[model samples]
Target: MTSSTDLRKAFAPTGKLRASINLGNPILANKNPQTGEPFGVSIDLARAFAERLGVDIELVVFDAAGKSVEAVRGEQADIGFFAIDPLRGEGIAFTSPYVLIEGSYLVPEKSPIHSNEEVDRQGIRVTVGKGSAYDLFLTRELKLAEIVRAPTSPTVVDVFVEQMLEVAAGVKQQLEADMNRFSGYRLLPGRFMVIQQAMGTPKSRGSDASTYLAKFVEEMKASGFVAEALHRHGIQGASVAPAA
Candidate 1:
């Protein structure tokens, strides 16, 4: 077992804990329009973790998941919320996922593609946020369709529509919102992948920090803190990930 002193030393080297907030992931976080503060399940979990560590918390905000990952990897922040992906595991240590989000594709209403399997055709062009989990996954999984990288995750839908791409792949919630915001677009029947939304700390922080964080996540999930946060934040479509 890791003692409080050791946990603090390993995870909070600067005597303070910083959490990176990625607004790109609407399931985990949302920007408060009036306060301009991020408040959502991830924010709640970060605050609670800081309290457990008995350290002051600071939020380093970013509009993209890639930026948030970079913050933790570079030690600009001690921890960050991220989608558990092998590409990102190089510099960061991830805890078991606290939430599971589906990754789906959106296509124009009149498009020939009627399902997720139809997306990987010879001439189809798919758009995704540059450096996003879907972008990384599809980059490897797509056999024939060309991938057009948008500037950020939040802008993937816009870029997809503007560029008239055949498919737009991203968080399922984002696609649903886009369907409401725009016309003539519908999500494919099911998800292409499940995004494991997790918390990560710099690998330089050591295994103790990693272990502590993983245990904390399991506790949060078992104790209903995660479910309550989801309800409090009015989040839907994301379920607490099963024990990892």
Candidate 2:
């Protein structure tokens, strides 16, 4: 168990816990259109962690996960919310995921790609967010399909439409919203992958911090704080991750 002093020393080295939040992922965070302030599950989790550490919280907001990850890597933020990926693990220590998000494909309504299995074929172009977990996973897993990376995840659908790509790979909820806003777009029946969303700190922060965060995540899941945050924020299509 991490002592309270150790938790504070690791999580708030600069006298406050700076949490890097990614606004690009709407499922984890939602920006208030009028106020431009972010409020969602990720924010709530960050706040709760800060409270646990008895430290002030500072939100370092970013438009994308790449930026958020960069902040943690650079030690610009003490911690960040990220998808649990081996590639990102090199620089950051991650806890078991507190939420599970589905990664799926979006295609034109009249497109012949009726099943997820049909996606990996010759000459099929799939657009994904550059450096995103889906991009990293598909880069290794995709057998035949060519992956085209957009500037970011939030922009993948737009890039797919503009480039006339065969498929758009991204968060299922984002694609569902796009299907409603744009005409003649449909999501594939099931998810291609499940993204494990977790909190991470710089590995250089030391093992004590990692252990504390991992335990904290399990506590939040067991206590229903994660589920309550999702319900309070009106987020759907996601569930609290199973205990580690």
Candidate 3:
């Protein structure tokens, strides 16, 4: 039977890993504003996988999170580091979620946002990235806030920077990067959507290879190692629970 080593050695992901790292999203994927170095959760996961398999990982840029998924489908990336969703699972294999993630609201400094009640109290303009998971969730869950959809992730960032306001995204690292820049970022007391996050492997892999890697990922999750890695990387906001 081919082991993880054998599969990776045989199919070492070729090409510059089209790293779909968004520009402003901090914890997931973003080039450092100061050093021009890409440092984030996605980078960490990709680096770990490459090291484990004795391969190399070269990062290429993707403008947004959704584009990252496209990169994998187009054979530009071996994988992308971000939350694995059921919709995405349709054509992919994902590692067991390392951290418990949730979607919440982040507003500008002292914006009279006292509770989830204010989600609709008055002129609450919830700006969101186009085609983002948070946009989908807000569409389904939010009743009162006016959803101001930005054309892209960067557009969303620009909107928030301009208004000093916007709703918090439910995604990880992205939220940390988006909301943490200002002094007034808060988790919005008791208001967030539960979003379980996992890593993704593209659908292009053969069924045999996919199943084998899935089992391997399950084992890693069971070992409680991914949690340690997440915490080590300054992404402590993700709730780390023992492997199920």
Candidate 4:
């Protein structure tokens, strides 16, 4: 077993654990209305990890997943919570996912699209947050539909509505909340994808750091910590990932 001193050296070389927090994914994180500080399951996990390492924490916040991933990949932050994707894996060493979020589509209620499968046909324009996990996945998977890039994940539905796009893809909870702002939008019958949300550090952080992070995630899941965080934050449409 790696000693706490060695673990701290690997994860918090700067003497503080810098965590990249993404506010765009409401299920993982969001601002406290009263305090304007980031809060949610991811924030809870980051704080717990810092406690385990006996280090102070610094939150490096971003409004989008792409920026958060880049912070860890560039070593601007020590760790981040992100949806696992192959493109991001090039520079990030990811632990098994700690949470699983559903990716769904939102469409105007009157639209003919009734299922996740129908959105991929020709002439369909799907809007997604630029450089987001869904964007990366759809960019590779969709052969006929056109994908429009919104400036950020939280803005995806806004872009879809403004542009009169056929579909908007993102975290199911986010899409559900965005639906209330419009009179005629509804989520499709089921999810298009299951996003594996995981903790990650820069690949340059070395194997010991990666192994320790992986173990931390598995323990969190097995001990009910992940589930408790979700319930505490009032998050919906996401679940604790199975122990890995």
Worst 10 residues of 4 by lDDT: 1-10
lDDT of 1 at 203: 91
Alpha carbon lDDT of each predicted model:
0.91, 0.92, 0.61, 0.93
Candidate 2 vs candidate 3, lDDT winner: 2
Give the TM-score of each candidate.
Answer: 0.97, 0.97, 0.74, 0.98
Q: Sorted by lDDT, highest first, which candidate order results? A: 4, 2, 1, 3
In angstroms, what RMSD does candidate 1 have relative to the true structure? Answer: 1.1
**Tens-digit lDDT track for model 1 on 1-244?**
3488988887778888889999998988889899998899999999999999999989899999889999999999999999988989989999999999999999998998888888898999999998888988999999999999998898999999898889999999888998888899988898999999899999988887898899999999999999999989888889999987
Angstrom error of the Cα, residue 102, model 2: value is 0.6
Q: How much is 223 displaced in model 1, in angstroms?
A: 0.2
lDDT by residue for model 2 (138-200), tens: 999999999999998889998999999999999999888877667978888999999999999
lDDT (tens digit, per residue) of candidate 3 on 94-177: 666655665666676666776766776456788777656667667777776788877675567557667755565445445555
Roughly what TM-score does model 2 have, to 2 decimal places?
Answer: 0.97
Name model 2 segments beyond 4 Å from true.
1-3
Best by lDDT: 4
Candidate 3, lDDT over the whole model: 0.61
Query: Model 3 TM-score?
Result: 0.74
What lDDT score goes with residue 188 in model 4?
A: 95
